[model samples]
Target: MTDFLHLLHHELLLSLVIVCMLILKLADRGRSGSSWSNLLNVLLLINFAGGLLIEAEGSLFDGMFRSNALLHFEKNVLSLGLLLVGLLATPYLRNHKHSAEFHILIASTLLGMFFMLSAGHMLLFYVGLELATIPLAALAAFNLNRGESSEAGAKLILSSAFSSAFLLLGISFVYGTCGSLQFEQIALTVSGNPLQLLAFTLVFTGFAFKLSIVPFHFWTADVYQGAPIPVAAYLSVISKAAVTLVFISVLYSVFGALQATWTPYLLITALLTIITGNLFAMRQDNIKRFLAFSSIAQVGFILTGILGANVDSEGIVLYFLLIYLFSNLAAFGVAGLISAATGKESILDYRGLHASNPRLAWTLTIALFSLAGVPPTAGFFGKLFLLTSGASLGNYLFIGIAALNMVVSMYYYLRIVKAMFMETTAQPIGKIPTGVAPAIALALCIAGILVSGLSGSFYEHIHLLTLSY
Candidate 1:
C-alpha cells in the first residue's frame, strides 16, 4: 500500500500540474491570459526536479517503485530530452495562437512518460503508454489550419489504435499463459510452455509497431511529413525512447528464457528495416519524410543491441539511445527552426542554406553526419558498441548487415549535406534571430555527441547500468 501510494504521489503530482495548466488555459478566456511559456517552463522544471529527487533517494517506498542507478540514468536522459523539447517549443509557440493548449498537452504527455520509465506492472505500463500516446495525436493535429497536419493526426491515431489492439491482445495472452501481470512472475512462467511462444510473438508485434520496423512502419513517413516539426521531433525522440525502454524492460524481465525464440525475429526485422528504410529514404524529396525513413533505419541498428540480450546489452542500448537522442534531436531542431523561419518543407528549398545561415547549415550537417554513423561523433561509437556486442554474441550476420546498412545510409544522409554545402541557392535564405534557448539546446546536443565520443567514462557508466536488477 505504501509503495503504491508513493508511486501515486509522484504520478499524481505531475498529472495535477498538467491539469492545472489546462484549467488555467481554459480559465483565461479573456484577453489577459497567463504566459503559457512561463507556465510550461515552470512545470517542466518542477517535473525535472522531482525526477532528480527520486533519483537521489535511490529507491522509493518499496521494490514496486524502486529507482536504481540505471533507472536514474534513464530518467535523467528523458528529463534532458524534455527540457530540449521545451526550449524548442517556446519560439515555435510564440507565433501560434493556441500556445497555452499546446504546452499543456506536451506537459501531460511527458507526465505519462515519466510514469512509464518506472512502471513495475503490465497494467501500469499499458496505462502509461496510452496516456503518452493519446495527447500526441491531438498535438499532431494542433495546426488544424494545415491539411498535412490534420492528416498526420488522423494517421497517428489510426496507427496507434492498431498497435494498441495488438498490445491488449498480447497482454491477455500473457496473463492467460502466466496467470500474472507482473514481469517477474511472467518471466518464471515463460520458461516452459509452447503457448509462451505465441504470446511472445504477439507482444513483439506490438513493440515492433512502436519501434516502426518494416511492414509496421508504413505510417511513419506520412505522419512525419504531415505533422508540425516540433511534434515530429517529439515523436522521433521522446516517444521512440519510451517505447524502446519498455521493450527492453519486458525482454529483460518477462521473457529472458525466450531470447532464443525472439532473436531470429529481431534479426530479420533489423535487416529488412535497414534495407527498406534506406532505399525508401533515398528517393524522398521532403526533408521530414527523409528523416522519417532515416529514423526507421536507426531502429534497425537498435535491434542489434536487443539481439545481444545480456546485461552488457542494456548498457549498449542505453548509450546508443543517448547518442541517438542527441544526434536526432539536433537534426530536427535545426529543421524545425528552418521550417518556422521560412515556411519551406522540401529538400529543394534548402539549396543555398549554407550561404545565408551558415551556422544552421553546419549544425544540420554535423547532425546528419552523426546520423550516418561517421566517426569522431557519438553515433560512431554508438554503432560500434552495438556491433561489438552482437559480434561477441556470435551474431556475425547481424553485424555485417548493420555495416552494410550504414554504407547504404551514407548516400542518402550525404544528399542533404551536399544540398546544403555544395548546391547554389536560388534565393538567399535569411537567418531568423537564433534565440538563447534554441541555441543552447543545439549546443547541448552537439556537446553530448562530442563528449560521448571523447569520454570513456560515458561508456563505463552505461556498462554499469546494463546490470540486471
Candidate 2:
C-alpha cells in the first residue's frame, strides 16, 4: 500500500487515462459523440490537474521506479502542453469520426512517457520507448484518406522498428558486460571496452533517432509534412521533450562512467545536427517540414548544454526546454490555426497576412524571432544560457560553431516573417478565422514566453529547484 502511495501521481494518471479510454471505447457509439469528446477533455483536464497535486516522492517497487522534483516537473510540463494540445486538437478533431480514439492514443503515448521518465531500469526504459513509438505512428497516419499520411505512418513505424533493434542490441551488450539491466548497477560495472563502446554508441544512436538528430533524422520532415497539423504539434514539442528528458537523464546517471569516451561523440553529433538542420530548413517550403528541421537544430543546442551534463546543468536543460516549449508551440499553434482556416500549408501563401489577421501575424513574428534567439524573448535567453553553461565546461569551439548555425537558422525563420509582413502577392490569403480554443492557447503560449523570459525570480527559482536534487 505504501509503495503504491509513493507512486500516486503515476498510478492515478495511468488509471484515469485507461478508464477514460475504456469508457470511450465501450460506452460511446455514433450518437452523442460530441458530448463524449467533451467528457474526454474534462477527464484529461482533471488528470493534468491531479498530476500536479500528487506526491511522487521516492523510488518505488524495489527502486525499479523512482520520482524526483525534476521528473515531476517534466510530467507537469508534459501535462500542460498536452492540455493545450487537446484544446488545439478540438477544432481539427471536430470533423473526424475517430476523434475520441485520437485522444485515447495521445493518452496512451503520455503513459509511455511517464514510464520512461520514472524507469530506473534499462528494461523499463526500452518498454517505455516502444510503447511511446507505436501509437505515434498510428497518429501520424490518422488521415488515412491521404497517401502522404499513410506513407508518413509507414516510414515512422519502420524507423521505429529499426531504432528499437539497435536499442535492444545495445542493451544486450550492456547486460552481457555489466551483468545487470539496472541503471545504477550498469553505471558501476561498465567501462570503455570494445563491446561496451559499441553498446553505448548504438544506444545513443537509438535516442538520436527519436530526437531526430542528423543522419538518423531522415524520417522527420516527411512525417511532419504528412501528419495532421495538431499531431505534428504534439510530436514537435511534447514527444521530443519527453525523449530529451529521459535521454539526458540516462546520459548523466546511467552512463556517466563513459563520459571520457562519449563526450567527443556527443559534441560532434551536436555540431553536425545544427549544420544539417539549418541547411535543410532553408530549403523546406512546407511549414511543418521547416519547423521539423528547425527543431532538429534546436536539439543540437540542447545537446550542446548536455555535453556538459551534470547536476547543476540539469536546471539549465529543463529551463531551455520550458522556454522552447513556449516558443515552438506558439509557432505551431499559429500555423495550425491559419492552415485549418485557409487550407494553405505553404510558406508562399502567407503574403500580406498582417493586413487582415494581425494577431496571427504578430504571434508568428514573435515566435519566429524567439526561435531565432532575438532579444527580449524567452528563446534568446534560453539559447544564451545553454551556450554559456556549455562553454563553462570549456566547449568554446562547439559554441562558436553553434553561433554560426544560429545565424543560418535566423535567415529561414525570418523568411516566413518577411513573407507575411513585407512581401505582397496578387491575391493574399484572406483573413483566417481563429477558433476560441486556439485563440486561448496562443494567448497562453505568448504569456508563458514573456513570463519565462522576464521573471528573473521565476527563472532562478526553477533553476535552484534542480540544485536540491
What are the lDDT figures for the candidates, one per model?
0.81, 0.85
Error of 2 at 449 (Å): 0.7
lDDT score at residue 15, model 2, on the 0-100 scale: 67
Stretches off by above 4 angstroms in model 1 are 1-13, 26-35, 56-66
Give per-residue CA lDDT, model 2, range 364-384, as digits (tens): 998888889998888888898
Query: What shift in Å separates residue 145 of candidate 1 from its native position after superposition?
Result: 1.6
lDDT of 1 by residue, 389-416 (tens): 7777786766887898899999999988
lDDT of 2 at 147: 98
